[model samples]
Target chain A: GESVGLHLPTLSVQEGDNSIINCAYSNSASDYFIWYKQESGKGPQFIIDIRSNMDKRQGQRVTVLLNKTVKHLSLQIAATQPGDSAVYFCAENTGSWGKLQFGAGTQVVVTP
Target chain B: EPEVTQTPSHQVTQMGQEVILRCVPISNHLYFYWYRQILGQKVEFLVSFYNNEISEKSEIFDDQFSVERPDGSNFTLKIRSTKLEDSAMYFCASTRTGVNYGYTFGSGTRLTVV
Candidate 1:
């Protein structure tokens, strides 16, 4: 099945640096995208979301960029902190009824 | 902030035993969903419920699995005759409209079938 995928399985970033996670989705029909952060033993926490009509959206310290032409999405975290160390997933909603297809997560390791 | 709540943080059950996972979605949300993630895998949608009925379900949600909103507040997933493959982290989520509105996920219940 055509699915969402990440470019990197793991990302190492120094604390206080900027971190970027990239994802590629194959389903062109997908119109909604979201970024979530999952810590150990916890549920996925919503970070940011972007609709296909928009190219970019921003939250507290996170930004989601969507490129419909390339079927790509990216999440950027500014001033990465140790608390940001977690597995990040990119999910796309292909249907209006709303079932999300999640990508293999990118493990972000924030190093002090 | 309103959030989804799940009960039984973890469960250990023998194969062929029945298990029920419970969840309390946000009070005002209209849509409910169940998703599962196996070890080292991405989250997979199991089922979606609306208006006290199942709106959609995935292939993994076979005859052994069922969902119900028996009362007005509690949504439950019952797995009959569990198998080892049924062991996974099950997460409950709710949204006001749909995924476009961003779903709030519960901490999840980890089920282990032996």
Candidate 2:
């Protein structure tokens, strides 16, 4: 079956440095993608999103880059902070009803 | 900011017992959804509800699972008979109709079947 997947399971980064998380999705028909942050024991919080028509989108301190040609998605966090330490998931919206298919997730750790 | 609310942060039930997970989506939101994540697994979509009916459902949402919007505010998911594999964290989410919007998710309900 087609699915979404992460390139890395964990990422360790120094505080104040930029962090990049990568994801790969198998379905080319997927039109919308979202990046979510989940703290321990909490639901996923929306960070940013991009449509297939656009290649990149930016938020407060985050940026989402979509590469449809390669079926790749990446989330870049600038000046990573301790609060940024969490499991980040990349999800693709599928079907007319817009049900999201989520990747396994990449755990980001920010160290001082 | 408005938020989605879920009840009973954690629940423990014996196999074969029924369980109902409750949620209250943002008041003005038009679409509601249910998703679940097992330990060490990805979040999986179970069902999406809109216009007081199910707009889409995954294969995981079998006959044993049901969803209801009993009133204007509360949406619920019921499992007729749970199995050990049913243990997971259930999250409720809501979103307004749009292609550019993101869904707001509740904290979640952790169900443990023994």
Q: Pick the candidate with the highest lDDT.
A: 2
Per-chain TM-score of chain A in candidate 1 equals 0.91
- Scoring each candidate complex against the real one, what DockQ results? 0.55, 0.56
TM-score of 1: 0.95
**lDDT by residue (tens digit), candidate 2, B1-114:** 999999989999999999999999999888999999988789999999999999999999999999999999999999999999999999999988843565899999999999
Give, for candidate 1 chain B, the lowest lDDT window spanning 10 residues: B95-104
User: What TM-score does prediction 2 earn?
Assistant: 0.96
Q: List the residue pairs that clash in candidate 1.
A: none
Give the candidate number with the greatest DockQ: 2
TM-scores of the models, in the order given: 0.95, 0.96
Q: What is the Cα-based lDDT of residue B33 in candidate 2?
A: 94
Model 2: TM-score, first chain: 0.92
Cα displacement (angstroms), candidate 2, residue B66, comes to 0.1
